[model samples]
Target: MVGGMHQRKAEMARHSDCFIALPGGYGTLEELLEVITWAQLGIHEKPVGLLNVDGYYNYLLTFIDKAVDDGFIRPSQRHIFVSAPNAKELVQKLEEYVPVQDGGVAKLNWTVEIEQPPPPPTPASKQVGFPALKKAEIAL
Candidate 1:
Protein backbone atom coordinates (compact mmCIF):
# COMPACT_ATOMS: atom_id res chain seq x y z
CA MET A 1 0.00 0.00 0.00
CA VAL A 2 1.05 3.62 -0.49
CA GLY A 3 2.29 5.72 2.42
CA GLY A 4 1.31 9.42 2.33
CA MET A 5 -0.82 11.33 -0.20
CA HIS A 6 2.22 11.90 -2.42
CA GLN A 7 2.96 8.21 -2.76
CA ARG A 8 -0.66 7.45 -3.55
CA LYS A 9 -0.61 10.13 -6.20
CA ALA A 10 2.54 8.63 -7.69
CA GLU A 11 0.86 5.23 -7.85
CA MET A 12 -2.25 6.73 -9.37
CA ALA A 13 -0.19 8.42 -12.05
CA ARG A 14 1.49 5.15 -12.71
CA HIS A 15 -1.78 3.32 -13.27
CA SER A 16 -4.29 5.72 -14.77
CA ASP A 17 -4.82 6.30 -18.48
CA CYS A 18 -7.31 9.11 -17.92
CA PHE A 19 -8.43 11.38 -15.05
CA ILE A 20 -11.81 12.95 -14.24
CA ALA A 21 -12.22 15.31 -11.27
CA LEU A 22 -15.34 15.65 -9.19
CA PRO A 23 -16.58 18.69 -7.27
CA GLY A 24 -14.81 19.09 -3.96
CA GLY A 25 -12.37 21.14 -1.89
CA TYR A 26 -8.66 22.02 -2.25
CA GLY A 27 -7.29 18.50 -2.57
CA THR A 28 -9.50 17.75 -5.54
CA LEU A 29 -8.49 20.93 -7.31
CA GLU A 30 -4.80 20.31 -6.61
CA GLU A 31 -4.90 16.80 -8.03
CA LEU A 32 -6.77 17.93 -11.14
CA LEU A 33 -4.34 20.76 -11.82
CA GLU A 34 -1.30 18.60 -11.22
CA VAL A 35 -2.46 15.95 -13.68
CA ILE A 36 -3.24 18.60 -16.27
CA THR A 37 0.21 20.07 -15.69
CA TRP A 38 1.69 16.65 -16.18
CA ALA A 39 0.05 16.50 -19.61
CA GLN A 40 1.39 19.97 -20.35
CA LEU A 41 4.90 18.90 -19.44
CA GLY A 42 4.56 15.75 -21.59
CA ILE A 43 5.17 13.73 -18.43
CA HIS A 44 2.13 11.65 -19.42
CA GLU A 45 -0.11 11.47 -22.43
CA LYS A 46 -3.23 10.79 -20.41
CA PRO A 47 -6.50 12.56 -21.04
CA VAL A 48 -7.76 14.68 -18.11
CA GLY A 49 -11.37 15.74 -17.53
CA LEU A 50 -13.75 17.40 -15.07
CA LEU A 51 -17.18 16.35 -13.89
CA ASN A 52 -18.73 19.77 -13.48
CA VAL A 53 -21.65 18.73 -11.31
CA ASP A 54 -24.21 21.51 -11.01
CA GLY A 55 -21.92 24.03 -12.63
CA TYR A 56 -19.62 23.85 -9.62
CA TYR A 57 -16.55 24.49 -11.72
CA ASN A 58 -17.98 27.33 -13.82
CA TYR A 59 -15.86 29.98 -12.16
CA LEU A 60 -12.70 27.95 -12.52
CA LEU A 61 -13.46 27.40 -16.19
CA THR A 62 -14.08 31.09 -16.70
CA PHE A 63 -10.82 31.92 -14.95
CA ILE A 64 -9.00 29.57 -17.27
CA ASP A 65 -10.63 31.27 -20.25
CA LYS A 66 -9.52 34.65 -18.91
CA ALA A 67 -6.02 33.34 -18.56
CA VAL A 68 -6.09 32.47 -22.25
CA ASP A 69 -7.51 35.88 -23.05
CA ASP A 70 -4.80 37.61 -21.02
CA GLY A 71 -2.16 35.58 -22.83
CA PHE A 72 -1.05 33.92 -19.61
CA ILE A 73 -1.98 30.61 -21.25
CA ARG A 74 -1.90 29.71 -24.89
CA PRO A 75 -5.15 29.25 -26.77
CA SER A 76 -4.36 25.69 -27.75
CA GLN A 77 -3.16 24.92 -24.24
CA ARG A 78 -6.43 26.20 -22.83
CA HIS A 79 -8.24 23.11 -24.09
CA ILE A 80 -5.89 20.80 -22.25
CA PHE A 81 -8.82 18.85 -20.87
CA VAL A 82 -12.51 18.25 -21.43
CA SER A 83 -15.33 19.13 -18.98
CA ALA A 84 -18.78 17.58 -18.73
CA PRO A 85 -21.69 17.71 -16.32
CA ASN A 86 -21.96 13.99 -15.64
CA ALA A 87 -20.10 10.69 -15.64
CA LYS A 88 -21.46 9.36 -18.92
CA GLU A 89 -20.59 12.40 -20.95
CA LEU A 90 -17.21 12.67 -19.26
CA VAL A 91 -16.42 9.09 -20.15
CA GLN A 92 -17.53 9.63 -23.72
CA LYS A 93 -15.23 12.61 -23.93
CA LEU A 94 -12.40 10.63 -22.45
CA GLU A 95 -12.93 7.95 -25.07
CA GLU A 96 -12.83 10.52 -27.84
CA TYR A 97 -10.02 12.48 -26.23
CA VAL A 98 -6.70 13.15 -27.87
CA PRO A 99 -3.53 14.40 -26.29
CA VAL A 100 -2.21 17.81 -27.27
CA GLN A 101 0.90 17.04 -29.26
CA ASP A 102 1.82 20.62 -30.15
CA GLY A 103 0.45 23.08 -27.61
CA GLY A 104 3.38 25.46 -28.18
CA VAL A 105 4.49 25.12 -24.56
CA ALA A 106 7.88 23.43 -24.43
CA LYS A 107 7.49 19.78 -23.47
CA LEU A 108 9.32 19.60 -20.17
CA ASN A 109 11.28 16.54 -19.11
CA TRP A 110 10.07 16.03 -15.53
CA THR A 111 11.13 12.37 -15.62
CA VAL A 112 13.69 12.37 -12.83
CA GLU A 113 11.36 14.24 -10.50
CA ILE A 114 8.17 12.15 -10.90
CA GLU A 115 9.13 8.73 -12.27
CA GLN A 116 8.22 5.66 -10.20
CA PRO A 117 9.40 2.11 -10.85
CA PRO A 118 6.70 0.05 -12.58
CA PRO A 119 4.88 -2.69 -10.73
CA PRO A 120 5.94 -6.17 -11.83
CA PRO A 121 3.70 -7.68 -14.46
CA THR A 122 1.15 -10.12 -13.17
CA PRO A 123 1.13 -13.65 -14.61
CA ALA A 124 -1.50 -14.27 -17.32
CA SER A 125 -3.38 -16.94 -15.36
CA LYS A 126 -3.30 -14.75 -12.24
CA GLN A 127 -4.75 -11.72 -14.02
CA VAL A 128 -7.08 -9.62 -11.87
CA GLY A 129 -9.20 -6.51 -12.45
CA PHE A 130 -10.45 -5.60 -15.93
CA PRO A 131 -7.60 -6.59 -18.21
CA ALA A 132 -9.19 -4.38 -20.78
CA LEU A 133 -11.30 -1.50 -19.55
CA LYS A 134 -13.27 -0.49 -22.59
CA LYS A 135 -12.65 2.94 -20.73
CA ALA A 136 -10.97 5.10 -17.94
CA GLU A 137 -10.31 6.24 -14.26
CA ILE A 138 -11.59 9.08 -12.08
CA ALA A 139 -9.04 11.18 -10.18
CA LEU A 140 -11.08 11.69 -7.03
Candidate 2:
Protein backbone atom coordinates (compact mmCIF):
# COMPACT_ATOMS: atom_id res chain seq x y z
CA MET A 1 0.00 0.00 0.00
CA VAL A 2 3.03 2.25 0.16
CA GLY A 3 3.09 4.58 -2.82
CA GLY A 4 5.84 7.00 -3.83
CA MET A 5 4.94 9.39 -1.06
CA HIS A 6 4.57 6.52 1.35
CA GLN A 7 7.95 5.21 0.24
CA ARG A 8 9.43 8.58 1.00
CA LYS A 9 7.69 8.56 4.35
CA ALA A 10 9.06 5.10 4.94
CA GLU A 11 12.55 6.31 4.29
CA MET A 12 11.98 9.01 6.87
CA ALA A 13 10.25 6.61 9.22
CA ARG A 14 13.17 4.22 8.96
CA HIS A 15 15.58 6.92 10.03
CA SER A 16 13.60 7.92 13.07
CA ASP A 17 16.71 7.98 15.18
CA CYS A 18 18.06 11.45 14.40
CA PHE A 19 16.32 14.10 12.36
CA ILE A 20 17.68 17.39 11.11
CA ALA A 21 15.76 19.76 8.83
CA LEU A 22 17.23 22.70 7.00
CA PRO A 23 15.47 25.65 5.40
CA GLY A 24 13.57 24.34 2.40
CA GLY A 25 10.44 24.72 0.31
CA TYR A 26 7.15 22.79 0.14
CA GLY A 27 8.85 19.44 0.34
CA THR A 28 10.66 20.35 3.51
CA LEU A 29 7.52 21.56 5.24
CA GLU A 30 5.62 18.45 4.28
CA GLU A 31 8.40 16.18 5.53
CA LEU A 32 8.73 17.97 8.84
CA LEU A 33 4.99 18.01 9.50
CA GLU A 34 4.50 14.36 8.65
CA VAL A 35 7.36 13.27 10.88
CA ILE A 36 5.93 15.35 13.67
CA THR A 37 2.53 13.75 13.15
CA TRP A 38 4.12 10.35 13.47
CA ALA A 39 5.82 11.43 16.63
CA GLN A 40 2.49 12.71 17.94
CA LEU A 41 0.91 9.39 17.15
CA GLY A 42 3.59 7.47 19.08
CA ILE A 43 4.66 5.72 15.90
CA HIS A 44 8.27 6.95 16.20
CA GLU A 45 10.62 8.63 18.57
CA LYS A 46 13.31 10.97 17.26
CA PRO A 47 15.07 14.27 17.75
CA VAL A 48 13.94 16.81 15.19
CA GLY A 49 15.75 20.09 14.75
CA LEU A 50 15.67 23.06 12.35
CA LEU A 51 18.74 24.88 11.13
CA ASN A 52 17.43 28.40 10.60
CA VAL A 53 20.30 30.09 8.89
CA ASP A 54 19.98 33.86 8.34
CA GLY A 55 16.53 34.10 9.93
CA TYR A 56 14.98 31.98 7.25
CA TYR A 57 12.52 30.12 9.46
CA ASN A 58 11.62 32.92 11.78
CA TYR A 59 8.19 33.42 10.23
CA LEU A 60 7.39 29.73 10.01
CA LEU A 61 8.20 29.20 13.66
CA THR A 62 5.98 32.11 14.55
CA PHE A 63 3.14 30.67 12.49
CA ILE A 64 3.34 27.41 14.40
CA ASP A 65 2.98 29.43 17.58
CA LYS A 66 -0.08 31.06 16.12
CA ALA A 67 -1.47 27.68 15.20
CA VAL A 68 -1.25 26.64 18.84
CA ASP A 69 -2.89 29.84 20.08
CA ASP A 70 -5.71 29.49 17.62
CA GLY A 71 -6.54 25.96 18.84
CA PHE A 72 -5.58 24.42 15.52
CA ILE A 73 -2.56 22.84 17.18
CA ARG A 74 -1.67 21.73 20.66
CA PRO A 75 0.99 23.44 22.72
CA SER A 76 2.69 20.13 23.33
CA GLN A 77 3.25 19.92 19.57
CA ARG A 78 5.89 22.61 19.93
CA HIS A 79 8.26 20.01 21.31
CA ILE A 80 8.46 18.28 17.93
CA PHE A 81 10.35 21.14 16.28
CA VAL A 82 13.25 23.30 17.36
CA SER A 83 15.06 26.08 15.53
CA ALA A 84 18.79 26.79 15.75
CA PRO A 85 20.75 29.55 14.11
CA ASN A 86 23.55 27.31 12.86
CA ALA A 87 24.63 23.72 12.36
CA LYS A 88 26.76 23.37 15.48
CA GLU A 89 24.05 24.73 17.69
CA LEU A 90 21.44 22.57 15.95
CA VAL A 91 23.49 19.44 16.66
CA GLN A 92 23.93 20.40 20.27
CA LYS A 93 20.21 20.91 20.70
CA LEU A 94 19.42 17.54 19.14
CA GLU A 95 21.87 15.74 21.42
CA GLU A 96 20.52 17.31 24.59
CA TYR A 97 16.87 16.90 23.65
CA VAL A 98 14.76 15.31 26.35
CA PRO A 99 11.56 13.57 25.33
CA VAL A 100 8.42 13.95 27.38
CA GLN A 101 5.16 12.04 27.10
CA ASP A 102 1.96 14.02 26.65
CA GLY A 103 -1.19 12.06 25.92
CA GLY A 104 0.42 9.81 23.29
CA VAL A 105 2.91 12.27 21.84
CA ALA A 106 6.65 12.40 22.42
CA LYS A 107 7.56 15.97 23.15
CA LEU A 108 10.91 17.64 23.71
CA ASN A 109 11.65 20.37 26.21
CA TRP A 110 12.48 22.81 23.39
CA THR A 111 14.90 24.70 25.59
CA VAL A 112 18.21 25.20 23.84
CA GLU A 113 21.34 23.96 25.60
CA ILE A 114 24.61 25.32 24.23
CA GLU A 115 27.80 23.26 24.59
CA GLN A 116 31.28 23.05 23.05
CA PRO A 117 31.48 26.74 22.38
CA PRO A 118 34.52 27.96 20.44
CA PRO A 119 37.34 29.21 22.66
CA PRO A 120 37.20 32.89 23.46
CA PRO A 121 39.49 35.00 21.31
CA THR A 122 42.51 36.66 22.91
CA PRO A 123 41.88 40.36 23.56
CA ALA A 124 43.89 42.82 21.48
CA SER A 125 45.63 44.09 24.66
CA LYS A 126 46.81 40.60 25.54
CA GLN A 127 48.11 39.77 22.05
CA VAL A 128 51.87 40.20 21.75
CA GLY A 129 53.69 42.46 19.21
CA PHE A 130 50.91 44.80 18.22
CA PRO A 131 51.69 48.50 18.81
CA ALA A 132 48.68 50.52 19.91
CA LEU A 133 48.07 53.47 17.64
CA LYS A 134 46.73 56.78 18.92
CA LYS A 135 43.42 57.96 17.51
CA ALA A 136 43.88 59.20 13.92
CA GLU A 137 44.16 62.99 13.74
CA ILE A 138 42.49 64.61 10.70
CA ALA A 139 43.74 67.86 9.14
CA LEU A 140 41.09 70.55 9.05
lDDT of 1 at 50: 93
lDDT of 2 by residue, 12-50 (tens): 567567777788999888888877776777666677788
CA shift of 81, model 1, Å: 0.7
The ten-residue window of minimal lDDT in model 2 covers 131-140
Model 1 alpha-carbon miss at residue 1, Å: 3.8
Q: Extract clashing residue pairs from model 2.
A: none
Q: Residue-wise lDDT of candidate 1 within 1-140, one digit each (tens)?
A: 85568668867988888888999999999999998888887878888999999999999999999999999888887778999999999999999988888856666654345547768777874776873563354322
What is the model-wide C-alpha lDDT for candidate 1? 0.84
Determine the backbone clash count of candidate 2.
Answer: 0
Error (Å) of candidate 1 at residue 99 is: 0.4
Q: For each candidate, what TM-score against the reference?
A: 0.73, 0.67
Alpha carbon lDDT of each predicted model: 0.84, 0.74
